[model samples]
Target chain A: MAAQTLLLKGVTKIFNKGTQDEKRALDGIDLAVAEGDFITIIGSNGAGKSTLLNVIAGTYAPDEGQIAVGNQDVTKSPDYSMAHHIARVFQNPTMGTAGGMSIEENLCLAELRGKRRGLSWGVTRARRRRYREVLKVLDLGLEDRLKQAVSLLSGGQRQSLTLLMATLSLPKLLLLDEHTAALDPRTAEKVSHLTNTIVSQNKLTTLMVTHNMNQALCHGNRMIMLHQGRIQMDVQAEEKQKLTVSELIDKFGETLKDETLLSCEPAGAP
Target chain B: MVILSVLPITLQQGLAYALVALGIALTFRVLAFPDLTVDGSFPLGGAVAARLIVEGVDPSLAVAAAVLAGFLAGCLTGVLNTRLKINSLLAGILMMTILYSVNLRIMGRANIQLLFRPTIFTFMENMEVVRYVPVIIFFFIVTVIAKALTDVFLHTEYGMALRATGDNETMIRALGVNTDNATVFGLGMSNALVALSGALVAQDQGFSDVGMGIGMIVAGLASIIIGEAMIKPRTVFRLTLAAVIGSIIYRFIISMGLRLGLAPTDLKMATGFMVILALGIPALKGAREGKIHLRGV
Candidate 1:
């Protein structure tokens, strides 16, 4: 009976409206996430998993819907205004951090998120110590190389740092859009483990989109399968624990007998 | 001794142009946009500052007003590109076209002479110091201050977001950074710096001409390309310093070329050729590498 941390009611998004190629990215959809909920989203291509995250992050305006984050109506909020409440880690590791800047500079930026920025002194000793402490927890040895350019880090390290940055401000909602899809298997695994640790430690409300069905089922407390821009199956902690990828596929196959569905098994699905 | 005496003047002019190069670097390098508005904005600053000074305004106040004017010009270009959805290159061209007349209107003619008027540099005359010495010192001080300010600004949270916006707009927007606002702000700041340089240059040269800004973007690009070739600094501070050094080297090259009997009218052609050479050399090297790989295959 905890209050919902995020509420989306009757959300709909249409692209190229009134054109020959008009398409509905999201149909009328409603969803609510309670505090401390970690929800995993799985969908085939063009199923609106990314679009939903985009809408919640204020990148895309919903044609019709109301989005509320902790009692604040943020449906029409501009992207800059939403920084105070939301943070996102993009799929590409390079997209989240500035490669031209040093690791410490990037960390300084994340540390000051949602705060008024001005021409001030560069990173101070106290701030550097804080960044070192935060980076040390990753156990990636990045703490020792704070002055290194972020571009020099491996993909996994960059994504892990991005996750740390996203959670730095403890936003009301954290959006992850296939955040590990671009990393190699070993690196992705490490980043995923770090993500789970951080999300649980912070008790954050999060929605993660994934192409890997096993990851969707194994990582979060809740799993939702999206089809044609709508949620087809939703399972909670116990149910999600019990559900297997094969069973989920069978359920999807039962509803939609398309050959494409049978061939779309996620490569990482066990 | 002749070269030695002219060396400082050339170096001083180069330092002044470094501010121009830094401004262009913000728009062209950081933002990755071909902003032609710098051409108009550069002279616009000089015209506004010169006219204000003639009207008895304080030199500092005139320079500030000139910077503001340049910022507005850049904002106009940004609005055309972002809100009106005009192509970025075209948006800059449109603004440049409009500002030509606007600059003339500001000065009430095609040019203004600051020869007899008291300028900001005149304050140094009150002290018993060598003429070129204080001027050179002033140039160095202003350039260093501007470069330091740029470094500090780019290190902040907002600056990181601004840099990220240029790398990938969609991802920046997804991260709750307003790409449009960043674009507008970045362009405004870039051109403001360029205009400030123009204001200072006008006073230094004793006149402002409507055509002074023509081909400025090309010259600035040359300085940047040359600088990047020499000093490859990954940090903002290093990058700004490289730009300043690059401007000096560019001026030195031009001065050397003139000293070697190159016609003044061919300066634009030489600048254009330098840019082409700078842009082409890397690609040519890359193509050679690809060919080598292909041969090995």
Candidate 2:
């Protein structure tokens, strides 16, 4: 529907290269995501889901391949250098936001991300009022407690704030690395809803890695099942909606040698 | 009479060393860096100021040069850590050791005496006040300016980035902040204040000795502990105020100990013990009261 915002060509990453324990975390892979493409990624553990996201976010450089964001060849860029165009939220709530800083301060810092930080006052009165307005979307009453340190927040609230922070600068690509995995089921559901809202509202090109099969099938316009560092299954909107949990499991069972992956229950299912 | 005699000395020492305490707090608390470079930079400042002033440089300009030298020295430590891939603590130690020889070279000896020179103290001596009053007032004004500048800087956008660099480097780096630059700047600012402190102290005491900065880190920590104990440091301004106030109180305590006949040679040991007691009490209490929960056990 739109121009390609993100592209990966023949990307491969091997951890501990040239060692006895050298493991190929990602194999030759090619992917392209268009503007406003919210793609969900699913795989068993060690299936290169996180590795793929990491390579895209510039946390781990690919052994061979090229990554382009917004038509800019960023294959050689450092993590901080790529941060101008890419925003990422880690799985750990604490990893996403600074615990020592206040909510408003955190948001203010996020606002200046990817921009030249100057000697100007960080949280001006105008910025604080704007933060209050932006935080009202969370409906967590975080606007009322802008001065409270993020450490004082509950896990779900922090994740929400982190998600807010990541999108504050309107990054070209957003990477969510199992961002809801650490939250409780109810909270996870809420965060998932918020994630969907933020992604669609901004029309952001997002790649969300999740272990939940149900979520992979339910959330995004497209679902890619990564198995053994390869795209095993790629399903589009109508086909993805028609796919069920049982069918997805059967498909995984056919190609994967590991039976341990079948035991991963979806959220809220005891 | 005894209190009057000790009061001016206590106040002067407290105010002067408040600069060092503030420097220590910046690296230790703000950046989470255990910078030992201040030890070398402190005396390095005094040596530079004392040497320059003795050679007919304006006392104020000499002090400025001392700050610049200290900033460069701190930046060297930061470069060693960030660019050279050395651990921050070891880099500071390396810088501190190297600065010893540099200080010696600058003064051409182990010490310099400015007994009859026109120093910052002499400039302030023209004021119509009691003998020690002007010096104390000068130190007060300088410390306040330094403290206020720190508070204002920490609120700036670049300052927030620096604070975040200390708070969560990974997160800030991911947000596109050049943390290496922030670290370097933070270390530089920290040591500049420490050097300023040393320059003023040397001028006030009329001498600069290579050994003056020995045991200084411990004294600074002790002052911080005393200040934190007296006033809870919630905000940036309060945190700095605590350090300055703590330095003053620590000086008073040392004076009291000396009045009670504690040997001057045992002063360092006494300060070490006070820090241990101050730091250990809360940790021991936490261990006694904090409950550990295990689910599967």
Q: If scored against the real structure, what TM-score would every candidate get?
A: 0.91, 0.95
Scored by TM-score, the top model is 2
The lDDT of each candidate is 0.84, 0.87
Off by over 4 Å in 1: A254-270, B123-130, B168-175, B288-297
Off by over 4 Å in 2: A254-270, B1-5, B283-297
CAPRI-wise, candidate 1 is acceptable
Name the top lDDT candidate. 2
lDDT of 1 by residue, B141-171 (tens): 9999988888778766677777766655655
Clashing pairs in 1: none
True contacts kept of 1: 0.35
